[model samples]
Target: MSGIEDLLREDLRGKTPYGAPQLDVPVQLNTNENAFAIPEDVAAVVAEFVGRELRGLNRYPDRDAVALREDLAAYLGHGLTADHVWAANGSNEILQQLLQAFGGPGRTVLGFMPSYSMHPLLARGTATAFVDAGREDDYTLGPDFVRAAITEHDPDLVFLVSPNNPTGTALDREVVEAAYGAARGLVVIDEAYAEFARDPGSTALGLLEGRRRLVVTRTLSKAFAFAGARVGYLAADPELVEKLLLVRLPYHLSSITQAAARGALACAARLQSEVDELKHQRDRIVKNMRAKGLPVADSDANFVLVGGLRDAAAVWRAILDEGVLIRDVGLPGRLRITAGSEEETAALLDAFDTVLERRPALFDLQEQAK
Candidate 1:
């Protein structure tokens, strides 16, 4: 610990955001972002909208984020209005607001492991307790397990992720219903990959509308291909939405972001088609990898998890040199590959094959060690 940093928050010691890897690799497949570029029309709309605001840089943005909220609520199709929405730099910050509103010392936030890495980190930021719901070997949560955890910990916040990252599995509907029955806590389902899933329309809102304790988080980074834009949304009961709005910084969503998100929403047909294309490619990737004797997780989103690769980091390093990049899950012997355009996907698999074929000695070592 640096003795000179005495003014820092006591909890800040030895903690930092999850460090994403940076590589100069050619084909980047690491972050689960959409590889497609934003539609030309959508980009033009954002440019024109922000062009109007270029001279207003000195002025503060709408503190309430009124326009973006209204558009988002309507896009969600849940009888929402501006009062029923809130905007932040991304859903990540929106989560921070939820924690602030509902968390404090001794209060606990609960979630499963190998899910999003941010859940526990954010809970710690609130000075609240954190708990985990254990999953079976396959990463599926049973209704019994959920009920057991709720009965045991009784957390104040429960984070859920559908079509989870790194694993790419979706929670079964029955399991979701049972989860709602199990907890009195605020249940937050992160559907950041929802748009790329089979039925992106099945948001948790429809199941528990008017319930002030339930919240749904979505991001435009994936489907809209605007990850750099940092625009995401929250769908909750109007009362909860109002609370988040009150806590958020003013004009968190820039004019460009608003225009870009709205433009993408208007071109839903094109976006949906892109999502469909990604899904098809993802299926083929999973199938081919599985047939190659590589263990892959069943996925409903735009990515696939290929397991059984010994030394995920070593494999990742090799892929980088092969002119491809994939996410290092840090889980022993596991790697996550994002679904890109058909050509991109092919390039990734070719690179994967090259690495695995030349790597019999690594796999032999792993088996011996095990």
Candidate 2:
């Protein structure tokens, strides 16, 4: 008999699952998670909200997640109502549902490379062909560049990640409009890190007025310190939201999750109070790294991407040896680091200092070239 490996789909025969290293270290600057913990006041409210649902354990959750969707809509505040919003266990699920509804065998989904990484993986999971159009060498997307790529691929779905992961590059509004104008398919703007953006008003949410094909995905995980809760949502046209219901599992979101998310939404202000600080640290990282002769990407997210390493893997290992964990996003000479609390940030910088003192050749491109 053939083994399970032999029975696996040919496309998935050599693929790796999407994940970052989950290791115990003195400081973790990987994965781009909010470093701050949820405040006690917010936790108490979430606990009370979740407690109320314990008595209804036997009953399935609200299959529609109507109230949760309402709360998410209110939080988003783009003149969107519950009809225009949808919730899921996480943004990853939301993306998957979209792929299921709009992308499948023979359909294509196009995305810029070095993005959230999961965009293509989710496409593959749904049997959708993924196309990488790639970005400029500096990792910025222009309106013309976006339109050209969308026109060339003519994908069924287009993913544009603002304050994009692993690079922290935010998409300009014109670029989003350009992609939407050129594509005949659904346009997805993954704004998972929008709360950390330098200009809060630059959100594509404002452009949702007449565009039915546009979707903006958001998550409370980063700003609200709710990564563990796994709450994510999206804002789109009501018709599109309805289509997701067909592909979503019944009672997909648990009552506890809905209640907790609602409670958190109620306390959005308090929960997101640390966002400014995180942005401060993000800028600090870019400034500090650039000063050290490293090329750091300008970030509007809670993380910074540093390039110019002679050996990124070796630098990663050296930093890990100092008990600091950052991400080596498979870029040849680059690494991504999350903005942590002041103390954690200091630890990360110190770890880098120590590593550079001992292994300058690994981190200093000039030295390596010499």
Candidate 3:
């Protein structure tokens, strides 16, 4: 082993970093990024804001990012104030900070499986124990299952991903409440895809009113089309915000990032207008895939989880060969696809059509659903 390799932290040895394949394909849907770009007017404003902030490049950004926090709090209006919101590079960093504050050696973190893949990685990165729990066969979480698991494991932190990744299904508000009630420590509702939800009001933010241990995290990456800005924030009790501060480094957010996020927030209306079209495409994909007898999970986000392939990896490769790419998340016979533009979605569906036409045995969803 190399000298540095031997000196690495024991827990870090032989660990692969978390990342999806960033292939340069015509249609890239592996990662759950917003398929659209920022609106032209919003881009112009963001450019101006960043340009103005460049003069202050010599100085560190607002260490607490107070102004940005205020903007974020205003953006996520569940009666959240600046003190109730915390911002960081992305939701990954936000979760890591939470783990740093509430999780460490000897502490356990639990999440429902086939959800966001990063939850356990963040927990382990913080030196916290990681535990995986399964969802129902339909890839939905039951409140009773959540409570029973929480009661059994008694983890220091719990993650309930609304509009869960891979599965593309949202949790019931009752499930979130059950998880919170069962946990003695912190309960985090990762709502990174909240904006794309079928019902915008169906959020855990309402459950946070009187609950001190509950936290609802959201990101500007998806609906705001600000993934490049790397802005993620959470609304929690003011006390939890205070705790995250202890573990976060000084000036964690750059001046450019702060200005960019605030600029995006200022143009929220223009950004949200694109959501309706995206949802239309999302629903279209679901309906069409179901008509083909595929076990397509009902999606509240801008993606769909499809099952019934005999060889998911093979299908993934065949689709890529057609100049389209989706994700084969190692779930047997399943793939996750992010909703894309009309043309891109058509390309994806066409790719699948070609595969199924020639290889009907491989695309049998009815039998696979069993």
Ranking by lDDT: 2, 3, 1
Model 3 misplacement above 4 A: 367-370
lDDT of 2 by residue, 1-370 (tens): 9998899999999888877899999899998899988888988999999999999899998899999988888888979999999999899999999999999999999999989989999999999999999988778889999999999889999999998987888888899999999999999999999999989987899999899999999998999888988988999999999999899998899999899999889999886679989998888888878777788878889999888898999999999989999999999889999999999888888888787788888775452110
lDDT of 1 by residue, 1-370 (tens): 6575576778877677776787776678888888888778767776776677678778776777677777777877767676767777777888888998887787988888888888888888888787887677777777788778877888888888988877888776666677778779788888888876666555576765656777888888888787888887887777787776556666666666676566666666667777888888898888887766777777878898877766788888888888998998777777889998999999988987887788754342322210
Q: How many pairs in model 1 have backbone atoms within 3 A of each other, for residues 3 or more apart or on separate chains, i.e. clashes?
A: 1
What's the lDDT of the predicted structure labeled candidate 3?
Answer: 0.89
Each prediction's Cα RMSD?
A: 3.1, 2.1, 1.5
Q: What is the lDDT, from 0 to 100, of the residue 173 in candidate 3?
A: 84
Give the clashing residue pairs of candidate 2, or none.
none
Candidate 1: C-alpha lDDT: 0.77
- Model 2 per-residue lDDT at 234: 93
Q: Which candidate, 1 or 3, would have the higher lDDT against the true structure? A: 3
Off by over 4 Å in 2: 365-370
lDDT of 2: 0.90
